[model samples]
Target: MTNLQDRYGRRFEYLRLSITDVCNFKCQYCLPDGYLGDKHQHFLSVDELRRVMHAFAALGTSKIRLTGGEPSVRKEFEQLIEIAANTPGISTVATTTNGYRLAANAHKWRQLGLSQINVSLDSLDPELFRRITGNGRHQKVLDGIEAALDAEYRKVKINVVLMKDLNHQQLPAFLEYVRQRPVDIRFIELMQTGLGKDYFDAHHISGESIKQQLVALGWQVQPRGPQDGPALMLRHPDYAGGIGLIMPYSKDFCASCNRLRVSALGKLHLCLFTECGVELRDLLGNDQHQEMLQQRLLAQLQQKDATHQLHQGLTGVTQHLASIGG
Candidate 1:
């Protein structure tokens, strides 16, 4: 069981697989105009995705996260979940969704061996939520959150993309929400990805500012150990659950990156900010060259960029978050 280790000494044990690039909402920061058209519609079949998971599991991968514009919107999403959860070496299966369909499927997800769930909930206010997602499904999302809680999932988390002058004021409310519920809320620093550069420039808020505010409020921050992803986990003595901050800019978040993203079209993204990738759809299901394909993937993993260059003010990001499965 040789694990996939990168040049920077980060072992890639978690795989973020984008089952589809299509999404229901037009989140201002993710997909401004909804799903990318036909050109981006190419997606991997469920069987192909299963085989890919098997390949990664054989390489010592133990966790697989299903991501997408909205993984719940993908057809036969449960089957995909089951596949990864049942994979030989994979021990955990998780999904990051917009919570549109979570309410209806939360129970099924829990029974399917899904150890964790992360739902994106930026704003609690209905109108503001609609404005942020560009869709009037705020009530549904809230209902989904409630349903997730009702499902009694082992790990339920809410993801908040903190944007300046947008949903930043909701941080306190989020903290309160987590205290009342068993779920944890994570605040992700707004990233400068493709297709949303203008929006990011206008709305990007540093997680550091939010953290300072929390500290000023007398919140005692207790450090938690390694997380499933890149978030910096903190426990507050006053708060019931944990709070996670993913600071990609102020900190060198890429230095400890331990995951790889596979696009819906079967392209491997060693880094979320980079467009460089290795296509693997053609090699799926080919036992004759499976070893060769694994070697090729290992080579690419070894070549992963030491760190994301966005921190240095570099531009030219052409991959949108929706397309990259963030």
Candidate 2:
């Protein structure tokens, strides 16, 4: 099978498949409130997700990362992981979860061949965590992180969405927390997409400044391997773990964007910040010819935006991160 390559010659091998949009947390920037109204109806079943993975695997997709409003909230979470890992061409299967219920399944997830697990933890302080996530499940997330480490997955990463004046002050503490553990800490720049322009303008923090601060704090930072997804990986000599800065706004993270996102409702998002996509669930559900589906997918891949224009402003995008399976 030929690789799925965009017009820019970027081969798309990574697929961020959102299992479900339902979530337990209402993180201010992700989902200010609980699950959005009626959007969960579009979630794909276990079989559907499996079929989607098989199609992508045939098209040379080597890596699959399951995301969601909170992926663990889905009923078929474990089954989906196994499906992705067992896919013919997929080399690794990973998932990003809020960690609210990860402790209960971390061991099982590792047994299912989940290569890596990324848990979102913004602050070390319990109170601050509660404020950030709009819930008091900070301890649960910590327990989940410990469970993943104990399960001995290849890597366990912590995702911190940096927001000005909101958990931003805890950067040093977050670094220290990961230094002692065998986990990678990723600091994500707040993206001005779907969260409303007002909210983004108020809280968005630059990843560049965060990286500079980490350097001043004596962390020997460097770029990670090409395989290390979009995150700008850095390491400190004294720490057991490394630091990753996902600078969505600092630079053109889209030049090498070798990924395609499929939302829970079956929409194929060419780029995270771009609203352009094709409705893929219909084709997959209709039992259309595999070659036909592949051609349609390739067509959309060619239409993928050269680079996300979030820097220009969130003029056209209105869907929240949850709806899009961030």
Candidate 3:
């Protein structure tokens, strides 16, 4: 099988595909103003997604991660998961969601062939969660996480976008929450999108600080898998769960990049912070274009920048995370 490799020798075996751009939550870092875009915008259909999945899988992509403003918001989400799971050469069908419907649908989704799940839970405190997400369903999300674990998913992860005065000080609480539960809690550094420049400036904290704390607390750094995302995994003997630090601003952060993103509208994004996207919808129109689609995808790898220009305060065309499923 031909692997999707870039000029820098980075081979991508994982794909982050956004099924929809519509989200219900108004997270402070993402859609702080709530979803304002066209709710009826045409996202990729199941057939198109199937072709996309097949093409990538044939190219040695073993994992496909469904992402979105909130991926579970799509009505055809279950079907999408099933399709990804059943695709040839694809061993993992994962998704990242806000846990809105997880409590009620986790088990069903697992049965439908979803292998891994990552829920975005910014804070543990109910009030803080409400404040961060601009919603009052904190308890519901917590219950959803429990449901995901109960469903016996292959792996369960929690995503926490760390902010200085928001939930950065709650590291101890997060650690304790994972002390007994077999979940991986990921602490992501707040990134600067085009629209959240002011907010990012006020809240962005270095993931290094948290890494130092974890080391001091006796957490040992673990090796990353071939297809793992940009998270520095750490584990402790005392805890059943693990800790992951996703520091996009860290030095050599892009050196281990192993994933590529595709927007709901079918645009290939070499980097999350890319200035522009290569339109792939035309090629996805029919199965006849599979060869051309794969060729286009392979050709675009030569154009991928070694690293994103986020360190230069340039967010490129990404105004918000929800736009392309952060």
Best by TM-score: 3
Window of ten residues with lowest summed lDDT in model 1: 220-229
lDDT of 1 by residue, 98-154 (tens): 988888889988888787899898898989998989988888888888887888877
Instruction: For candidate 3, write residues 1-326 as lDDT tens digits.
Output: 34799989899999999998889999999998899998677999999999999989988999999999899888899999999999999988999989989999999999999999999999999999999999999989999999999999999999999999999999999999999999999999999999999999999999999999999999999998866668999999999999999999999999999889999999999999999999999998899999999999999988999998888899999999998888
Query: Alpha-carbon error at 187 in model 1, in Å?
Result: 0.7
Q: Pull out the clashing pairs in model 3.
A: none
Q: Compared to the true structure, candidate 2 yields what TM-score?
A: 0.95
Better of 2 and 3 by TM-score: 3
What lDDT score is found at residue 59 in candidate 1? 89
Instruction: Identify the runs in model 3 with alpha carbons over 4 angstroms from their true place.
Output: none
lDDT to native, each model: 0.82, 0.82, 0.93
* Model 2: pairs clashing at backbone N, Cα or C within 3 Å: none
lDDT of 3: 0.93
- Report lDDT (Cα) of residue 76, candidate 2: 84
Error of 1 at 153 (Å): 1.7
Give candidate 1's root-mean-square deviation (CA, Å).
1.8
Question: Which candidate achieves the best lDDT against the true structure?
Answer: 3
Clashes of each: 0, 0, 0
